[model samples]
Target: MEVTDVNNVKIYNLSCGKTFPDWLPDRKKRQLLKKEPSLKRRIELIQDFEMPQLCNTINLSSNGEYIFACGVYKPTMRCYDLNNLSMKFERCFDSEIIKCKPLSDDYTKLVFMFCDRYVEFHSQSGRYYRLRIPKFGRDLDYHPPNCDLFFVGDTSDIIRLNLEKGQFLNPYQGSSTSFNCCKVNPFHHLLVCGSTDGQVEAWDPRIRERVGSLDCALSALTVDPQGIPAIRSIAFKDGVNLAVGTETGLVLLYDLRANKPYYTKDHMYGLPIKSVVFHQEWVISMDSKVVKIWDRETGKPFTSVQSQYDLNDLCLVPETGMFFLACENQKIQSFFIPSMGPAPKWCSFLDSIVEELEEDQDDAIYDDYKFVTTKDLEEIGLNHLIGTNLLRSYMHGFFIDHRLYNKAKATSNPFAYERYKKKKIAEAMEAASGDRVKLQPKLPKVNQELAKKLYDLELSGDGSRKAKQTVALLKDERFKSLFENEDFQIEQDD
Candidate 1:
């Protein structure tokens, strides 16, 4: 549905199901219950300074206060302030910092990993040391036990490393598989690892042997909220439940203790479930490109948002309710969980559709047209349908009062008349606007940015004044030199 923002009038395109569901009350009743949040919150673009020589991957600190962005090129590490959205500091590393995690107690100590499977221990003060592992490292996590070691998961094996000793030990060598993710158990000596083969296996680093194993089968697995490894990446909240994100973007929260899943919510599309986290109140998942949050206890889907890019790494910052979305492009996007006070406007729309469908006793007649609505045409908007002249038949249809097979003869260019109508309307509007707009002396365009800026300023309330100022400014030899620059030129053909 196309929802217009009364503030700015910019409309957003949304799917029908998104704004309307099959279980809600009538539209009037739904509208009375809640109002749509206005489109006042446009995306504010932050200027990126201290540009990396080459961008790779990005991660945020556990507290969401700092961002650690790394690039494949030299000068690998760059740190930015999450609050102000600006680069606060930067450091050049020997190689790209593929991943970084800060110790809970000491913010100075950071575990940095590189693409070459090399890891380094560095202090915020610039002192650093490296740990060497034979197998290439794919992902790693710190083992919180008193053993003072970090567990590193690679494509084929799991390894244990003592950061202080720079020593490494492989707990699982031959069982090596395409490992994807891993976590250290809270109360046990077992380290859980997930693989592409859909297996979640536990290994006792002390004995260097496998203890428990479960087939997650393309399921992003995590130890359940109850601290058990029943499935991969699926977790529990109240001691008997399980929450899992599947490869098909179906997030399931089950009550294993009850031998049943509490509920399941399919993401709008099929996206490879990348990660899942069970907070005390929410079951969150990173699937394909969206961050999905659901109710932990009820298993009801709450809300979802695309993280602005393909998310490769993700984690939630405890206590603050903030989350970090890390992209392979070396940019980390941090977002805060908005309070669950008023639901989105689309929620109300869905509720209305559902209620109407239930109230209709003769639902079969309208079953095929259930998806149809006036909002559909408005949502597609004039811009997208402008160039494509098929809107008449595709976006609308003519009704016939005749019986049986009475029909309008199909025309090759059914929307041709509609296209002409719209074109004439646009030309009339353009001509009306041209009456007051005075043409300016064209200058060679120096750059797109400058051209756009000048256009915008001239289009502002004081176009004549701005035009005169531009003409005077262009008379300067320095300004004329800009036109001669290799970057600037306006085609005379126009």
Candidate 2:
């Protein structure tokens, strides 16, 4: 017994799912109900900016206004404007940036840890100051309460930089265990450091010494005869429970009260666990090979994705499903797991964008012309029209008119109709540009006196009302005329 769909008079497997029917009058209504917002949107949020090569680290500011990313290939740091969905600015450094962190809420104050055993402080405009560290820094975490920065590196000690005093403080020395990463628990005075010797150390910043350590790889299901797996990442769940990711791709959940791990989960791939995040109800771990999410308590597998890119780092907008991954070969990519949490207050439109994506059938955007590869050209029976102006040659393919696909195929001449096709393409471009375009170049409408007044007012940071009044007076219709008005006098130069 077959049942009909909600759509009326179903043609039984019509092309409506792939393309809007030509005879259909209400295409949007058919798609409206199917596009209801759900908690399963996991598509990449495309941002408008140029991406850097080998993005090694990423960080979100305390406020959701900006996102920062660093790439080692060119030793450059890129900041994205989340509010406008565009790039704010990019800065180049002398050495490869191991990690980038924001110290200020709005991303105005930032610190870039470089591989050259030095850290540079960058303000909103440019470099403010720099300090040389003892060892090469791997990662860093900022403690906002005390205005301190905890840095982990190739050494056993956790170096501290007193941001307020602008000097290096006493180091948090631990056993001869090289540290990989450090994270400060927001709910407590505890700071956790993941070591290269498969140990996660707990330190009390007030006492400035080691408190406790959890061995993540001890008594494991499958013991590696070579050596113990290194602890690569650590995330504090609360004041007690902690999440630790290891080099062997295992995530160990620990109860700070006990020595043994409460729950140990594996990613099964022997890759180094680069990041571990504790989202609502689930524990997310990324090991470059894949990203796995599992239940927090029972360790039941929720979902896993094979992100084959060279994932070097991961950053999450805490409390939300939104997280970003940094790759070595590709640009930083962001994913929103709608089921975990709703989009933040600043980016509420993400819900509608995801819903709209559901109604879109084709991956390519609708435009005046569409890119067609060799196979597409063959399928459309226009392979012989390759060299003609009707098919504009681009990278590895040609762009053909989307509306006149049939007409483009009818133009079988590879050479004879070149001049005619060129004229038609030019005409189409002119029509798209419209009549507002002028034939001659024109200058911007800027009055010299108004611009001078505004500039002086900005530099002085005074008299807002005076600047506005000056602009209003300069923009008067009488003064703007070619002939000077009697009310405005111009001094004659000798």
Candidate 3:
């Protein structure tokens, strides 16, 4: 028996639960009858590994071979092989793990940050060392060119450390507010830090000063009534555009050329945005319950999936188009995102109509005006000699009358007359030597005695009060020359 769809087309074989198009050729129909299911799913959850405690953070190696995860409830760090989906190693920590980072692309050495103001260095060769810091470090990032140098951001400043010598380097002051996250621009080698005050500051480590800064609160179109939302997560796209997530669940994409965000999406309502990842042309934002994928170019949400656990961190494998989500429920979930294939049916249809309209427009004929030649002008009925003489006389008379009218008008106004005289003098000077007119410098008109008096007042113990008094005195026309360079004395005398 054949089943018909809503469009009244035969699409299904009810007896065998098979589906085939009515336009299928006999040879293709036989092949379809022998073939297996063609409706294969695109995304599949490969493995979901549960840990002993809730994992709060996760980092993948640059080579995309291993994963490093840490938990707050349990003071332990674990490494897992991405290919085999098995735990490679696990080490117990003295305190709760705040963050973890792989030291190299091979994942041989690892750095772990703890809440007890200590950073631990562990290597595959069974070597380890612990360094105590003054304040609790919130985020850690390694310099792209030099892996031996890493930066840690705390409440008030960012500290640079040398991993080779296990010593601290120069410390760079960041925002007055506490830092919540930090990242290093792989292309520019600049350190970027996000603070609890909703500000992102980019510092050049060589000069150790802030080069650029943007306030997330100011870029928002609508302010969150509660308060200034803190920047919780940040990701870079193309090393120039930055994607920042706020506590109020807003994702803002900032182009380096402009101070404001180029695109803003309210991904979640009230929940804090936990993680943001940029892969290819897709931007993934995760909150407590949902993971949203957005088209980076258009800022339109492509798809959203509901999750059972609260996601903490997300990492994408560049080699394969797969991404991993570290959840608060101690499970790391993997998902495969397929590429954007053919255009949608509606889009293709609209494009076809546009193409047809463009073709129709190309076939249209238009008339453009061309320049008239001398022969055509003569053909219109005037002798060439008489027309040429008449045109020259008309041009000469027009310029002569215009010059006379301007001279008459200038004579009526004293300022205009003086300006006209000066212009004529400049023109004569230029014609004489082909040199531009030079401007004369004015002599300094500052009163030495008044300046000395003001300087002595500022040097006095009551400088603040005397400075206020001096400002008030300078407001008077008689004493204004002490502060201004203008020759007001000549104007007053006139």
How well is each residue in 1-494 modelled by candidate 2, as lDDT tens digits? 01122212111110012223346668664664367432122222344332545778877887777888888656888888887777888899999888888877876888888888889998988999988998888889988878889989888888988988988888888785688888999898688888887778888887777888877668343544447888888887788888888877778888889988878887878888889888878898998877777899998877664555778777778787667777755446556665667776667776676465446625544467888898978865878888998888889988888876756555644553665666577668768877675454232244444445544544333334765665454456765642244344334452
Cα lDDT tens digits for candidate 1, 373-442: 2344333332234334433232444211222111221133466567567667767876889868677646
- Residues 135-155, model 3: lDDT tens digits: 788788888554435445556
Show where candidate 2 strays beyond 4 Å: 1-46, 221-226, 356-494
Candidate order by TM-score, decreasing, is: 2, 3, 1
Which numbered prediction scores highest in TM-score against the true structure? 2
C-alpha positional error of residue 12 in candidate 2 after TM-score superposition, expressed in Å: 28
lDDT of candidate 1 at residue 396, scale 0 to 100: 49
Clashing pairs in 2: none
Off by over 4 Å in 1: 1-65, 71-75, 81-86, 104-106, 147-156, 173-176, 186-190, 204-209, 218-268, 328-332, 340-494
TM-score for candidate 2: 0.62
For candidate 2, give the lDDT: 0.72
Per model, state how many residue pairs clash.
21, 0, 0
Task: Give the winner by lDDT.
Answer: 2
